[model samples]
Target: MRAEVHAYVADAARLNRQPVLVLDPLTALDCSEAGYAEWFTEVTEGIEAHRALVVLKDKECEAESPRTTMMTVGVRNLRAAAPGAMVFLDATQLARKQDPPGVARTLATWSVKETAGVAINVGEHTPQAVADRYGIELRQTLAVTTGRRDLYVVADSSRGGVASADGCNPSDARIGSYEVLSDNPETTQHLWLTTPGISDGPCGSAPASKPGQFVPELATGLLAGTP
Candidate 1:
């Protein structure tokens, strides 16, 4: 399983090495004007092909601040130049506790215009739900949980399912089918009976297999557990 995860991450890295543009709206206010100018030049110079531009698009900024104007101009320019680049405009900075409604709206708009993904950073943020409201692709992050001994599939909350959809997504998913796609074969327990889409099987009462010990039939059955 460890080997499999490493290989998967490696493949994903290789596939996404294309030139990218990152628009940051979070750091343009604090630093000195000269410091920002120099810092932007220094950072952008190193990654000319991988562009990173900072904008001061905070909703709270004065309408007259040069940084505010620059942010608007920069976003307009970026929209024209790299229309398809991955774009992220932080809205948290603009709202109460960084939960600005306008920021969420901005994220949804940019996500659609750029046809890209957005990350709503922490801070009681429910921005992803707002993204869903806009019909934007909103996939929640899934993390691997490891016991003192080893890594395993604890839960996947992306779907808001009863137990959350974990184990794997089905291959060749139909346009709107509710089938469990592919079972991730690497989780430590890999218990099929407890999974969301498979039927109960003999493994229902089977003890979780330890690290380095695999029982394919029991695992397969466990993963087949249905919602």
Candidate 2:
């Protein structure tokens, strides 16, 4: 599994794309402290070599605060091994037992300044419900071009007005989707914007147009700096 992960990262880096690596420490739990340290060192070195982002899913078990300790160790190791890479904590498990807002705040506070951000899976939960829990507002609607199959536009709401148009016109060949955008533009962030029941899966359905079909022409009219 680890070797597969390394290959995935290397492939993404070779193509000049960023890859996100998700890790669950079930195996690490059984290893001795020294063994765990060595494992983490090797993992961090691999991540540094590939310049990938990591998401650690902190799960609780019988041991007293094992997740908390593992998170601490993981963050410390990453900072030492790969200071340039980003780390995200997926605290969906913890959020199940506690208030989402409180959990989000606590994780943000506990995280190091360099720690990228935190995420909650909210599986089987409505996006609105989760947003309300975090006190996040839906400030804008983005009508991203369905024309570009490979491109997904991610904008920070706090940065304000990612694109010129607020809503899509009837003639537009784009889909209107919403998300909780970040305030900080410098953060490494990605968002998926899809209508309800519209699966963004690769083999789902064919889009009406080809890649760059509408964006180039639309950008000339909408984007400020485009000629």
Say which candidate scores most in lDDT.
Answer: 2
Off by over 4 Å in 1: 1-15, 18-30, 51-85, 95-124, 134-227
For model 1, the run of ten residues with the poorest summed lDDT: 142-151
Residue-by-residue lDDT tens digits, candidate 2, 1-227: 45776787889988998776666665563534454566677677676656876766566645544555667677778778877566766655555566644564445444523465554432212233333333221111101111112211132121122322222211222322234345553322333322222222222122343321333333222233423
TM-score of each: 0.31, 0.54
Q: Which candidate number maximizes TM-score?
A: 2
**lDDT at 148 for candidate 1?**
17
Distance from true location, Cα of 71 in model 2, Å: 0.5
lDDT of 1 by residue, 47-66 (tens): 33333222223334333344
